[model samples]
Target: MNPSRPAPLTRVDGSPVRVLVVDDEANLSDLLRMALQNEGWDARTAANGQEALNLVREFAPDLVVLDIMMPGIDGMEVLRRLRSTGNDVPVLFLTAKDAVEDRIAGISAGGDDYLTKPFNLEEVVVRLRGMARRHVAAAAAAETRLRVGDLTLDEETYEVVRGGIPIKLTAKEFDLLRYLMQNQRRVLSRSQILDQVWSYDFGGTSSVVEIYISYLRKKIDSLGEALIHTVRGVGYTIKSAE
Candidate 1:
């Protein structure tokens, strides 16, 4: 019998991993994009730091390949702004300088990893996979109590409450809610929800995500201004009602 293939790495919401490749060199960015796409990941390229910053919001990449030396904003300043704004997306720095100080500065500026120039593309892919895995694992492990507005979920006690009213949920429902709460305002594709909350081995389809989302809405949204929301043509998100 053949061994089953491993599940692909994904965002907490189960979407294809997104990567932003930022470098002044167009050729290098193009090459990186091709490599990432070959790995079944989405990749976007930015010519400079400013463009990189813009794409971060528009693309919402899970990881960033930032060039430390840029004409304007530079990688360090870019990393600083991202960190300051509470954006903890993992970053890998690319630098032409091989000095110890250069590597240290990149790390000090909040880069998760750094690669010197003329590095191997294969190595880049390996490091990025590692970072993506670590980041996802860290996000899953770091939170116990997730809150959005007045709604809260306690991972330890498996309790869910909204506006001080306790809500009961089945085990699957609880897992679904926890995944959504963990992702907060981020739109979670049905496929993402299915993969993370219910395994393919569980003999379920993406429709199960929709059904449970409906269940969650009836139980939780019915109590308040509706934290559970549907993003048309995309998926769902749990956000504070405006």
Candidate 2:
């Protein structure tokens, strides 16, 4: 498998995760598409709020990357409509406006996270991964099982299965696996994982995330079917062999 594109993320029942990117800037949209694709996520793009809403109904994405400013409906209004419809898919707001009020407004409008413009792509990917992880953790209680293609994670027993075989993971490995499984197809920076999973502020080094990722790769991807990919100059993602 190519190192650039990993495998797709699947539910416990084996359904792929879908993502929607809404931005007026074509270049930014393309960048997001590339980043998400590297993670094996099925991502679609919309140039404006109206187009975003249209795709929301059709694609039913697992997550949304929404830009606040737009020609017509705007991100806040679109989020309102989504919430009105009871579609609680996580949304990460991307906008040029970086004010406390703006952040509050975005969150108040049902945004799961807020990212300012001119931000690092790694940061965006990391925040999105966190949102996805939280969403999956919530659903894990009900599902009791989580699987992506041939790999399976049992929430009840904390067991992992690959190609119908059992795999052992250390405590940290298990936590990392759970985080990766939750985020699945979204790129996660080493610093971001350290912050979320480690529950501490990360210093200026990525050695920890890299080391654990290496450990995970040995156990999860040593069999030729690569599930973890490194995005050069960015971060890593847990995706299926693509």
Which candidate leads the pack in TM-score?
1
How much does each candidate deviate from the true structure in C-alpha RMSD?
Answer: 8.5, 17.3
TM-score of each: 0.66, 0.56
Overall lDDT per candidate, in order of appearance: 0.90, 0.84
Model number with the top lDDT: 1
Clashes of each: 2, 4
* Model 2 lowest lDDT segment of ten: 5-14
Candidate 2 on 1-242: residue-level lDDT in tens?
A: 87685455554456655779999999999999889777667789999998999999999888899999998899999999999999999999999999999999999888999999998998887777777667766665768676766888988899999887788999889888888888888888776788777868555554878888899889888755888888988888777754
Q: Model 1, residue 153: displacement in angstroms?
A: 0.5
